[model samples]
Target chain A: MAMLDVTPQANGTAPQAARKPRSHARMAWTAFMAILRRDIVVTARDFIPFLLQVLVQPLFFLFIFGKVLPNLANSGTSSGFGNTFTVLLLPGIVALTSFTTALQGVTLPLVLDLGFAREIDDRLQSPLPVSLVAVEKVVFAAMRGIIGGTVIFPLAYLILGNSFQVRTDAIPQLIGTLVLVAMAGATVGLTIGTLVKPEQISLLFALILTPLLFTGCTYYNWSGLSSIKWFQIVTLFNPLTYGSEGLRKFMMPPITVTTPAGPQSFTIPTLDAQWIFLGLGVAIVAFFLIGLQTFRRRVVS
Target chain B: MAQLTDNAIEVIDLVKHYPKAPVNAVDGVSFTARRGEIFGLLGPNGAGKTTTIGVLTTSVVPTSGKALIMGHDVTADPIGTKQLIAIVPQQSNLDRSLRARDILTFHAAYHGVPRRERNARADALLAEMGLADRAKEKLTRYSGGMGQRLMIARALMHSPAVLFLDEPTNNLDPQSRLFLWERIQQMNREGLTILLTTHDMLEADQLCQRIAIMDHGKVLALDTPDELKKIIPGGTSLELRVALPQPALVSATGTAREESGLLTALRALPGADKVDEIAADPNDPAQEGITRYRLYGQDAGTLTAPALQAVSANGGELRDLHLARPSLEDVFIYLTGRNLR
Candidate 1:
């Protein structure tokens, strides 16, 4: 019984015609592109809901902090900090929105994919290595971050009007920061998705991410914590802090406000771009490796 | 022309002992499924059928030994082997976000089928699976049967050399089961080497050219359905129920088969080769004093009259007498002494 030598195909018409042989690299690349394309098509069909999902929180924050609070603060003793606050807040909002958008982009879909039904099997069946599938998730999520970041600019302008100033120089540095921040956000999202139980997702936000976002230095410059030296060091633990500081380094210009007294400089200090990129690069690599390990355990078993 | 090795799947002493498992899930299982034949792994749940399919599909790594698909080692060359095989797993793993047409097309794309060829094949498979009209429908709207057909269509997208169906019709209605059975036969006829796992004895009997009957992580019997039935001394059996000689008034219900000597007499009959005295279930009071014995022979017809004569000669009253054609179920019971799992 171990040896079956019967020629069952002797007279059987070959079910498949001979396929053209493809190189291993070519097949893997094709499968990767297919998964990416499928994700894009799915996202495009529900683009409005997607936009609502990632944009709602950031937009609400932008309106409340960038417009309402600063205006209210102007009527109070903290008068000078209003417009200067919104100016620095613009770049920080861009950073956090991009980071959180990318994070949610990967984590939400992965909850369904790795749930009991394991819908991920549909793609895992493809002729690609296990790690490549996780890579695809990160790549697609990064694209969403880029889109969220781009869309935030126009929306921020509408909220702050002339207060949203950008000396949009260091074009290459800005681009690099955008890519690095998006990648960091996505890899962290991947890690959470694979490691946490689906039911723990909501709790993860309420506990881990919300507090992290609050301390990420998105509403204020990282250097503004010089008075609270402990928080100055503590905020660095948040990956979103590096992203916010990185975007601020390249995007924010020194604020100049002309008042009844005279023109005054409103200084909002930012961390150096070099240090921010270094921290972000390390986090992305570390989370990517961790995500890959967790993803393989959850999928292949 | 010299014949190349045409076995589509070769599993050699494959074993998978999951970490912390008390026993190996698949213990030294080995079999070669010849090309274009419908081969079956018939076993109950937890009998290692799914694990074996996992090993073959490269989803479950073996703890020891090896499995190959068309000579590509599963562990060493999963990508290459995966290119030649497609699996329809027990659970529905369909991408619920995509339309049925997109599901097929995306599957083709994943297999590296070129863009021009993808749509054509997807449409063709949909039409063949009787899902052409609902090609644009969302998966949420699909019935279980329709979804199963869609899975079948998706698996065929790559025109794979080997197709693995892990309990293919597990939860489908009978109508769907029959439809899928016909589809499997058609695919096998057209020269696709098909390996399916099913606990359905009728399914194995009706569909497979050969079957491996597994129990407790081992293949207990492996042969064609007819050949397996021949494991019992009779391809047919005389299923006889007879009342035994009266015991003492105090011991009336129990010990009587030894007193009657009918078991030995039945075994000594002209055509009968084997006899088993079935112990009446003590838990069931309905079978109180009657003893049942099965007389197995090459031809059960020849044993009926002689068995009745022997019973009468032994002063035992015949209760029921019928010739039973042995089934794979009987063979399983004969081999394992347990039914189902």
Candidate 2:
């Protein structure tokens, strides 16, 4: 028979004689989920900022380009043929909305907190690997990206009216496009967050984000750059172009065309849809790797 | 890798030097903490105590040395080593955005505490640390004491083999400091190894089983409280208060002197044990003329009746009598000619 040793208890409750060992596997799951849950909950703390970031900008773009720009173009034309403007602007609006939402949701806060406020130190100390913490941030950004993109959809649909085809068959492709686009955007945001110091963050806004907005294939398609060969060559360096072009292929496949009349047509031509999607995927993975490595280095060293 | 021992902590010449600083922050500091012991690392500000704790907790890597917790090298296997240790930073790093209870639960989950067990542990720690009432409140609403308590509870989430506290009560009020000490003592009683750093001599005296005083990035002294006090040659030099602080015709009994007041220093008299009661100043020192003797004794009670009579005969008023014993401060002065605090 095994003998049991007795230890005195501070409380009145007698020792239970048997204590259970902890399950580390279960704890890992709890840790990951807890981070995700906490991040989600705290995002609600700044409700107005969240709304402005996720809904306001997308709405502004949709109303301006989706509704106003096309209307303005139609009024100038006696025939009132501005319906194609809606088709062209809707996909770009979706891509732009997701990009902005993802960038703000993950990048700015991550860089500031990890660099100056040091709010992320608590999470880093958790039993979870540091990479999981970074992943949680990206995951939260992805969720917000989906929300921002979806918010613009109904408004764009109302503006596009019957001319905007739902293309139910393209739903799967659209969802796939959104996921890839969000990943690419968020990963790029993470890369930016890692590269910029706390003081240099505003410089990133002026220099990096501005360029991203212009060249991210939001207002125009890759094929549209044919008129300016140099501009097309420069845009090849912008990862956002691949994401926006891939999204256009998914949301408005019929719009993927080129008149070849203007030196730079305002439509996507010569750019292969499959290649754009692959490039976006590749850029997303590469940025994630670099960002994660940078994050790990910052946390450890 | 080394075999695990009953000692939860073993540090061998742990050294850490920052690139920006000219000297090493922690230099060749080595110590061991047995299981269930409250070991203390004491030093003045910038004395390398926090840096040493950082190395042990795997937060900052050591420059050239190694620290092992439960047989895991802190540098080579930080994840495995961190699994057995938790650190309470000098500054509060609790997520201000998180509710107090969620803070506890989140820390638990991060340490791989099981989901079902996490809530129970969180509740128990909160209640034990007197934080249960405020557990639902956000951290931004917590006071200094409450934040420190929450940090302590956070460290307990994993039930780590060794808990490292870096100045756990630095800015806390006295009452909160006492409360935290009691909880830490309770934790130690349950067979958990605790390593703490502080410059408060009184705290170290009360809680540490063994202490190491560090200064200028080096260990000045390391010993049990009683043994450390022995470093002072003639125990404590008492300063007795009489109506007249200035003694007339100061005389030396044994190896002691009447420095000030009715205070007389006796080198090695009898009946000067630690439990001996110390008398107060005379009621009317100016009128009745109070006389006090400053008794200086070695090994606690080196002054006694003979020395007292001699002081009384030597124009000293016997208004109040008092005996002082060597404190950790005296040991600090003996080692570095300065107080530990």
Highest lDDT scorer: 1
Candidate 1, residue A88: the lDDT equals 80
Query: Candidate 1 residues A1-301, lDDT tens each?
Result: 1111122222122434556677778788999999999999999999999888777877898899988988898887645688888878877888888888888888877876787767778788888887899999999999999888878888878877877777666778887898888899899999988888878878988987888788988988888889999998999988889999988888888887777898887557788767897889999999999999998988776
lDDT for residue B66 in candidate 1, whole number 0-100: 86
lDDT of each: 0.83, 0.71
Per-residue lDDT for A59 in model 2?
74
Q: Which lDDT value does model 1 have at B107?
A: 89
Give the CA lDDT, 0 to 100, for residue A289 in model 1.
Answer: 95
Question: For model 2, how does the per-residue alpha-carbon lDDT over A120-196 read when each residue is reduced to its tens digit?
Answer: 87777765667888888888888888777777778667756665644466788788878777877788888788778
Candidate 1 CAPRI assessment class: acceptable
lDDT of 1 by residue, B1-341 (tens): 11256888888998899999999999989998998889999988989999999989888889999898888888997787778888898988898989999999998899888787778777777777777899998988899999898898888888888999999989899989988888888788778899999988889999999999988788888899999988998588887888776764647444454444777788788888777776676777887777778777889888888888998988889888878888776777677755554
Clashes per model (N, Cα, C within 3 A)? 0, 18
- Fraction of native Cα contacts reproduced by each candidate: 0.53, 0.36
**lDDT, candidate 1, at A279:** 87
Q: What are the DockQ scores of the candidates, in order?
A: 0.31, 0.19
**Which residue runs does candidate 1 get wrong by more than 4 Å?**
A1-17, A257-261, B1-3, B238-323
Residue-level lDDT tens digits of model 2 in B1-341: 35447777888988888889899998888888887789988888899988887777666778888788877777786666666777788777788778899888877666655677778777776777677788899877788888888887787776677788888888989888877787777778776778999888888999999998888888888889898887766676553434333434453442133433223333334544222113333453454434333444453343445655555554454555555677776566556654454
